[model samples]
Target: MTKVLVLYYSSYGHIERLAHAVADGVRQSGASAVIKQVPELVPETVARKAGYKLNQNADVATVAELPDYDAIVIGTPTRFGNMAAQMKNFLDQCGGLWFEDRLVGKVGSVFTSTGSQHGGQESTLLSTHTVLLHLGMVVVGLPYSFKGQLRMDAITGGSPYGASTLADDGNGGDRQPSDNELEGARFQGRHVAQVAAALASANIGATL
Candidate 1:
């Protein structure tokens, strides 16, 4: 079976929820989905005091296991228009993988959340894409066919870059990812997995 990894970091549960949604979408496409998270950098007491969601269910992911997946869907909360330090730190550990070209020809995608509607959501996703590209992975994104990203009916988060969600501008972390945003994530997951499955089945790398 084709395997995809939903790798993410969440401070207040927003990205965590989206990770699960993405995983569900992956499964719908008949690919195996595994959800994991980067380790928290904050000290336990500090994290608790900062109101971080300390009870996330996903296990901490190691950099070594990333190459096992045929596709990887990364999620993170934007920090000043970029991926959070925790996620960056985790990705930084993959220098060995990059040097070995271990992730080349694999599928890669990204999703993100921000504190406000215009808060660097696309910036986060796109910058992350650069990393995936450097790793020689085929990048996939949430295309317009999802429809939810095009919706102006309500305050939402999503784009051609990837699925996204908006936070409450740090107003106590009240704004959660909406159904539409979750659907966008699901769509992204399914889209990426389908592409990865096709690539895996094609075994195009074997001829190269």
Candidate 2:
């Protein structure tokens, strides 16, 4: 079976909600989706004081398991125009996998949440893509086929880069991902999973 990993780091649950939506899309395409979170780097007392979503249901993911999935959908809240340090740290530990080229040819996708409409959403997605490319993965983004990104009537977060959402006021704000944003995430998930299933079923790299 085609397997996908929806890996994310959410300080206050905004990206967590989007991650589940992405997983739902993966399941829509008959692929198994496992959602996991990166380890929190903040001290436990500081995290609690900041009201981080410490009780997130997803387990912390390990670098060793990332290669097991046919596709990986990454999510993060933009931090100064890039992925959060927690997620970046997690990926940084995958040098062993990169050295082995273990993730070569796997599908990779990314999503993000920002505190404002212009708060580095695209940059975050693009920068993350750089890592995926370095790992020799085939990258996928939320293409125009997902029309939710085209809606202009509301203040929403989404782009050709990937599925995204605005995180309300700031890191700890209460605003959740809007319906259009979630739909876009689901669309991205389905697209990535479909592509991975096709590649896996064909066993296309057998030439090696």
lDDT of 2 by residue, 1-208 (tens): 8899999999999999999999999999999999999999999999999888899999999999998899999999999999999999999999999998899999999999998999999999999999999999999999999999999899899899899999875655578899999999999999999999988878963221
Q: How would you encode candidate 1's per-residue C-alpha lDDT over 27-81 as one tens digit per residue?
A: 9999899999999999999999989999999999999998899999999999999
Residue 86 of model 2, lDDT score? 98
Instruction: Give the TM-score (vs. native) of candidate 2.
Output: 0.96
Residue 39 of model 2, lDDT score: 93
Task: Please list the C-alpha lDDT of all candidates, in the order they appear.
Answer: 0.93, 0.93
Give the Å shift of residue 42 in candidate 1.
0.5
Using all chains and alpha carbons, the TM-scores for the candidates as numbered come to: 0.96, 0.96
Q: Model 1 — which ten-residue stretch has the worst lDDT?
A: 199-208
User: In model 2, which regions exceed 4 Å deviation?
Assistant: 169-173, 205-208
